[model samples]
Target: MTKLTLGVSSCLLGDEVRFNGGHKHHRWLTHTFGQYADFVPYCPEVAIGMGIPRNPIRLISTDTGTRAVDSMNLTDDYTERLQHYAESIVPQLDALDGYVVMQGSPSCGMERVKLYNKNMIPEKIAAGLYTGVLQRHAPAIPFEESGRLSDPNLVENFVQRVYVYHDWRTRQPWRTAKELIDFHARQKYLLMMHDYPTYKRLGQKLSNLKDIDNRGAFGQAYLVELMAALSNIPKRGHRVNVLQHVMGYFKNQLSEKEKASLIHSIEQYQASEVPFIVPVALLKHYIFLHGDQFPYLMNQTFLNPYPEELGLRNPI
Candidate 1:
């Protein structure tokens, strides 16, 4: 398997990269992704001669939200330094499949960062400096704030995105019918949540990939279509769609009573946004107890690490 690379703010790694020299140190990230992907930590502030344990930076907009901007040292020193550092490391951002940004730092916050008034009054608009840079430099790069990963669903979603992108990159050299089928299989549930027609259209385009002689051009075209199709944002109602698909994988192996229970659990989940893990765990338990029934799907990419990692095992 190709290794996934993810860029993360240095503060999240327990480094004293903040203006006040404090580290956020997200435990879940250090414990989980540290095992798989290679984490590249970056500290734009520290690189700017701002020195660790320095003065706190502030986000100030001279005008309104539309004109709200990041500035410091009259020249917007912090934003300028961060921009230069960010631009210099464009190659690193280009290499990464995703990034984990600090939630609300003037330099690293992903959203709703503090917007300060030039004087005593607080302003209405607050935008993160680092967030702006990352967005501009790598518009296509998927990123999420470190704090948001606590929601298992969001965690799984971002992970799936990274893996899907990685899969797309790794499979660039050749895309076979078997590979397409497998990719679609993992993406099926993720698809139903966003746009069904787009997914199918991309699938249809993939059918031609195997026949075309220009492998390189074909591969590039396929990536554009495939990424667009798979990038749909997951939403509510999709729980039912995902549940039904997951059930189909387990139905044959499960007893009628067990099936009813699992289905009921799914209903509760839809009404409640409870973790999907409850019904899924029950089904998985059945699979383990009754191993002979659905052997192939047990190892399917869709069934193995995804929903489970996303805490889809029980309810929410």
Candidate 2:
């Protein structure tokens, strides 16, 4: 597999670009995930001419809206500059499969950055100035905060989305109705695991592709919706449902003992007695044993969303 190209905050990559000239180097991102990805670092504040060891900035709720301004001198605003820097990098950012931003950054945080009112109290929460623009420009790209990556589920979800988006971007899989159908077919079970209602609705849209005149527009919209649906982490009940659905494919082939064992595994997962990987591993074992008879099940992306070596499912 080609290494995913990811945009990351320079600080997170150990660049001393912060206001205090410190780096927020993330070990897992640099040493672990980095093994499977190539990083493109960005420091919007530095790019916008804020020198290292400069005065810190923060989000301020202004009369116009939230603005990035000097923490000590609120009148010295950098909102426009940060936004412009982000816009200038649109072409570069378009090539990235995903992004990992520095948390609580005035220029790079993905979410929950502090927004202070005139009283200096954090009155609101908002995305960082730079990332906000980037997200608005390209909503489909998977963006995760370095802080949030500590959560196993969020890490898995982000990596899964990145791989899916990269596949769609690189493969350009929606050129024809048949290609679109095949792409969606591969994602069917994966979509069901994340959001069944969206799975059905998206399927309905593609049911009669003859009605669609603009394939490009339809494809873009479909991807945005699909990524949005996948952003919701699958609930335990949803996973159990998907697991059972996959299990149904081998109902007759499995012996009574095998069936009972699979049922017990699913029940254990549902009851929170084990991590999601336990049952999934067992299911994959069965698939390996009997997948030749059920080719469709063999092709489901839900079975192997991302590289297993990441150990993302272990914690989840």
Clashes of each: 17, 0
Candidate 2, residues 50-140, lDDT tens digits: the string is 8879999989887899898898897899988888888999888768899999998878888889888888898438999999999999998
Candidate 1 lDDT, 1-316, residue by residue in tens: 4568888999999998787668999988887777678899988777777777776777765553322232334444455666777678786765787889988777777777777666735543454676677776665566888888887666776776777777665564555556655666566655655567766776776665554456566555555555555555555566568668767865777788988888888787777756655655666677677756655656544445433343433424
Q: Which regions in candidate 1 have their CA more than 4 angstroms from the true location? A: 1-4, 62-72, 115-127, 174-182, 194-197, 207-236, 246-265, 268-274, 282-300, 305-315
Model 1, CA-based lDDT: 0.67
TM-score of each candidate structure, all chains considered together: 0.73, 0.96
Weakest 10 consecutive residues of candidate 2 by summed lDDT: 208-217
In angstroms, how far off is 224's CA in candidate 1? 7.2
What C-alpha lDDT values do all the predictions have? 0.67, 0.89
Clashing pairs in 2: none
TM-score of 2: 0.96
lDDT of 2: 0.89
